[model samples]
Target: MKSNLVCRNRETVRINEYIHMPKQLSPAQVEQFWNDGFLFPVDAFDGVQAKKYRNLLEEAERDHPGEIHAEHRNNAHYILKFLDEIAHHPVILDVMEDLLGPDVLLTGTVLFIKEPQTPAFVSWHQDSTYTGIEPKEGITVWVALSEASSESGCMQMIPESHHQGILEHHDRFGENNILTRGQTIEGIEKERAVDVTLKPGQISLHHVRTVHSSTPNRSDDRRIGLALQSFIAASVKQTLGEDYALSVRGQDPFQHFLRARRPQSDYEPEGIAFREAANQRLSDILYHGSELKRDY
Candidate 1:
């Protein structure tokens, strides 16, 4: 057992390699996730593959500036082949199938990156606050393409907060906030927060209603994470307007929303239309019931 595939970007990544990393959660681990609302450090791939994907992402940023910029960051897989491949990754989906059952649908992805020494941060919020899905069984599988350490402002979760069942949230639309609506849940116990530090190719999965946020990056390297969000059970239906998702796994008998296809290339017609419809509906859903309307 010499090949641990340590992520070179962080000293702790190598230190953590000796520990057992399972592609799928154990029964006991599964119980803990339900009880705690979040689980982390699930092995999805090796650091070598992670580095390759990182390079691909940076290359895209350099070559095609606006393609993955702004709101495009939300559904990046529509334009980038690597992101699409990552979305449909078998190892990651195996873990998803374990938690979400055989019939899984992927709504979209969000690429959150914190530049070194930047004040950019996500406010405390539950994803269920915006995503208008019923039954609330959806999960967000956040995959780290780079080192996600405490110094890098890794996500911090309020354990078992999903049990609180979508607490009240207010919108700030703050200057440095990275969230679409700058949505925030007030009054969290900081003493109870758990830092979800991860290394390249590792992933953290959390319930849709889990309360979470991140601090600003203090480290020299940019912290990059691809959130494969809204992995929902086939039985769940959209409570808001029309939405779209790709059936990444088994059959979807309910058919709550329109089925989206993987883009053949960057900015193709079908993909563009799919993204426009889904994103527009998402905006309305997230901005629903807000008294203060602000440009996001």
Candidate 2:
């Protein structure tokens, strides 16, 4: 059964409005998030800043395209200064801290790019299903680097789906499917899905267990978005194996994962080495028990 905020599912507990928390989001917005398992249009970057970041990404993509593809996309922050800064952005962290408490650990980041007119699409799935992170108390902050409109195939999520807890998923790994395993949850009513559209500078926050997906980009321009895969409380731990994360806020006395650091610059030698090791560990966690291990 549902309470005031979110359902008492395996991933997250109920959070009431009366509790003392940060004020980045208004009371009503927070209520919507709890009730819907997501919130959007959170202003985090200015237009110029967003454009600049986008430019930076494109520049790197043009310069060293291979580094940003496949599994490398999982943790570009380890070697890309822009991605590092984006992952540690204060505004996004503030929202995370407010909802999940003071201590926040950024587990990973995923750079999503849907090329114009491409068949790339994300199947319906919950973020926490394959993550191996327990307590499921985390939020994904999807920051748009370009316009995220329906035409651009913005994220579509089902309200209160997280209440069902961790549902079963099948790995189809379909061609054009952007997900590693093409992991999906079947039998969702399309009409009930809500399109999370955003401007270049805007961002959306969604519960880890929330069911979400995106269609192929139909817009003329490349659809770009950076997903801060998860920001969890310092108390959270990985059940799979050795893990690493960045301490974004407050104190992390738990030390559940190894310390992750910032990238000195794009494709820095030291940073790339760290990223490779981190990705190898994260890969083991995300793709455990699966025979079909993808490069990305």
TM-score of each: 0.88, 0.94
lDDT of 2: 0.86
| Residue 181 lDDT (model 1) | 78
Which portions of model 1 show Cα errors greater than 4 Å? 1-23, 267-269, 291-296
lDDT of each: 0.81, 0.86
lDDT of 2 by residue, 157-209 (tens): 99988766788899998988989899999999889999999999899999998
TM match of model 1 to true structure: 0.88
Poorly placed runs, candidate 2 (over 4 Å): 1-21
Tell me the RMSD of model 1 versus the true structure: 8.9
Model 2 / residue 181 / CA error / Å: 0.6
lDDT per residue for candidate 1 within 194-296, as digits (tens), equals 9999999999999888899999999999999999987987888888887888899989888997887787886677776776666676677768877754433
